[model samples]
Target: MHTRRSLLLTAAAGSSIALLGLATPNATALAATSDQGLVDEARITVQDFTGDTQFTDMRRKLARAKGVFIVPQLLKASFIIGGEGGSGVLLAKTQTGWSEPAIYTMGAGSIGLQIGGEASEVMLLLMSDKAVEAILRNEFKLGADASVAAGPVGAGIEAATTTNLGADILSYSKVKGLAAGISIEGAVISARHSRNAAYYGKQAHPRAILYENAVSNRGTLELRQALAAAEMP
Candidate 1:
């Protein structure tokens, strides 16, 4: 058990470093980019997910989602021990529309023999206010801080929709441009306060950014519009 835990921790840290643009000592490219870049990617991701026929069930859930977390590119690579990490934004549904996005990071690791690499688009539908509240904290853990279930896909989607409704969050992912089942039960999500500050030009708590309407950006309008369109019946 200790060995497994160590592997997970190591993998998780590796992923964080990679996402922060430190994958290599002399690597010219930075994984973390401008806030506007992330927001743009998020808009595209939402459009891609909602427009896909494969995600018909996800659209159903989005219509009733209390909030949504969109991660445009979750890069998962492993030679033996595996890890995945990406940056994303969380938006809450408001009386007027979706709130401006708050910056966040998601990472997870696994202890197994695996040899592959993939970049996936992931979205987590916050089904309950409790789920949104937990995520508003400094850190939240899936399957610990909140109940999470994978959103249904493929032929069984219709039957599976009736299940997992009681969960606080429903997670969906697309790999290589097609829907795929993903297991992120042990993932850790942390607030990217520095990035948020950079994006909003001031430090603000996630609660304020997401709930209190303390900040707004003209840049995120398109992303908000895309999400609102998806939520519409």
Candidate 2:
């Protein structure tokens, strides 16, 4: 158990360092750039996040989420105060269906009980109309404009019975052997204006893509499929 934990931490830290721009240019260049490429990458991550049997409860709740944000890979490296960052895509559950994803960036700094490096899979399910509204803005801080909590995972836990519905959003992170929940209390979620601009051929915001129903799911077939499975009642 001790050796496994050490490996998990080491792997997480390594992923974090490379993703956080602390690695060489070649390593950094491997990070997703084109919007289509990121959408493709995040789809694979979503598969990993939901594939485990342990996520049954969380997956059920995700189906009902007003909007779901997928941070495929979040890297964090720290000695005292560490920096964590990742890029991902968001899909709003429209009246019709899940809309195309809008790319976004999530970042935060921590100085608490964290010691070594960590890489994680971050997911946020917008649980309320107001919570979805809070994320549509230019820059939104978790646990401030809207409440956020780690969604319960694993078997035997009933999503409807275990969750605090008052929370606007439920967050989760799965890191290797440590597949449970983690807090993203102070993280900032922002629309990737440049990526959106380049991808859509103009300046686009989360408002226009997710809320207003301007974009369609052309390149997000896999992601939408994964979300559809999670949404199944």
Clashes of each: 0, 5
Question: Against the true structure, whose TM-score is highest?
Answer: 1
In order, candidate lDDTs are 0.82, 0.72
| Best model number under lDDT | 1
**Candidate 1 residue-wise lDDT, 147-227, digit = tens:** 999998766678877788799999999887888888889889999886676677667998999888888789899999999
CA RMSD per model (angstroms): 7.8, 6.0
Candidate 2: give the clashing pairs: 12-118, 12-119, 13-117, 16-75, 63-231
User: Which stretch of 10 consecutive residues in model 1 shows the poorest summed lDDT?
Assistant: 23-32
For 1-233, candidate 2 gives per-residue lDDT tens digits of 33443454345445544555344554343332345566765676667767777777667788788998887668788876778887778888988788778878899887766688767777888989888788788888999999987777766567354566678888877786358556677889998765565456555677788768665546678788878876546
TM-score (C-alpha, index-matched) for candidate 2: 0.80
Worst 10 residues of 2 by lDDT: 25-34
